[model samples]
Target: MKMDAFAFGITNWAEIDRTEHQGETGMAYWRTRYFGNYPNQIRVRWVEYTPGYRADHWCHKGHVLFCMEGELETTLDDGRKFVLTSGMSYQVGDNAEAHQSYSRSGAKLFIVD
Candidate 1:
């Protein structure tokens, strides 16, 4: 989706499409749904991971993530780990460094990229 710089918008989670993630393995399945083509090419989405879920690839891009429901852990290639619970937030740059995530139980997050 594309956005017009001058436009304004409003939305509710129920109104957006929930798209299944493509590609990946492990019991690590997940789903993401977002609305709006925000300015500066920003994308906002709601992501949920199943119990014992782990991401397929290490992400190198920057993101602003907020934990909305459940627990999730993010581990950097350098072995740094961070655990986030509800109401917690994390922000990182698009440093070419690698990072991956997992959840022992399950997790729901609001993410901006």
Candidate 2:
């Protein structure tokens, strides 16, 4: 069967409640299993955060972050900082360093793994 046959859906993040964490604020996540099976997975998520909000220092197993709207300021464990805006994307390998993200005027992101 075609992937799209079993993997089709839409989500509105603005209607979901925000998840809060220490050092992180005004954040929210909406996850969906779109395609593939367990072990071999395909998932999509929408992440957002408001101004002055920050994420804890952590790394992903292996994933890519695609900016959908607004701006994001990311700081890696190695002290490297990146300023990302809409239409921007980046990768975080298994060996990726821990990092924190903050926003000045709120931001939205799409995470695919």
Candidate 3:
């Protein structure tokens, strides 16, 4: 990824407005901040998943996702599954794989894509 030049800044996630996204089985809330513009923009988010959450679709977009609290399970379309707990993270490239997420006990995460 090419990162265009930009100034450094700090974000107070609590001050950001959260938008809700319905999952297949539960709900997800996200506080997002964007740097640059679409096509080349970087999306940074603070996300929360409710218990029993399951992603509604397979995501082919890449991401750098970090688990901040609780646990999360990510399953690839090919039947591979991986788990993430606090302090754990995963990185994937754009269009590399189609994956979906699930959380049995809910979770908090930081993601950039």
Candidate 4:
């Protein structure tokens, strides 16, 4: 798919390129991508968090996430916990919460930001 093209119908992830995303500490790392939702309406990617992985910082960005494999957890600054197992999904509006994610056993998720 063309990077500059408008997002529309189906596009396969297997055919899309990926980039490694780094954090402030680099300990919370994952592969990422963007596109497939029309211009800049939405960005999509698959996140792969290794076992014992967690994000380097609390994030305030919103996302629509679909659990594709394994398990992962999202914690709100207020100590709320949200877990995503295989086939489980979650969503949060951008910058709605000061949250972070962790995976005791790793996880693969379909994410739209």
Q: Candidate 4 residues 21-108, lDDT tens each?
A: 6543233333455554564555667777777777888988788889888888889999999888999998787678888888888788
Worst 10 residues of 3 by lDDT: 1-10
Local distance difference test, each candidate: 0.74, 0.70, 0.95, 0.73
lDDT of 2 by residue, 2-79 (tens): 123355556675655555445546554444434567556566667767676677556545568898899988778788
lDDT over C-alpha atoms for residue 25 of model 4: 27
In model 1, the clashing pairs are: none
Candidate 1 is scored at a TM of 0.79
Error of 1 at 102 (Å): 0.2
Candidate 3 TM-score versus the reference: 0.97
When sorted by lDDT, best at the front, the candidate numbers are: 3, 1, 4, 2
Best by TM-score: 3
lDDT of 3 by residue, 1-113 (tens): 55677789999998999999999999999999989766788999999999999999999999999999999999998999999999999999999999999999999999999
Candidates 2 and 4 compared by TM-score, better number: 4
For model 2, give the 10-residue run with minimal summed lDDT. Answer: 1-10
Per-candidate TM equals: 0.79, 0.71, 0.97, 0.76
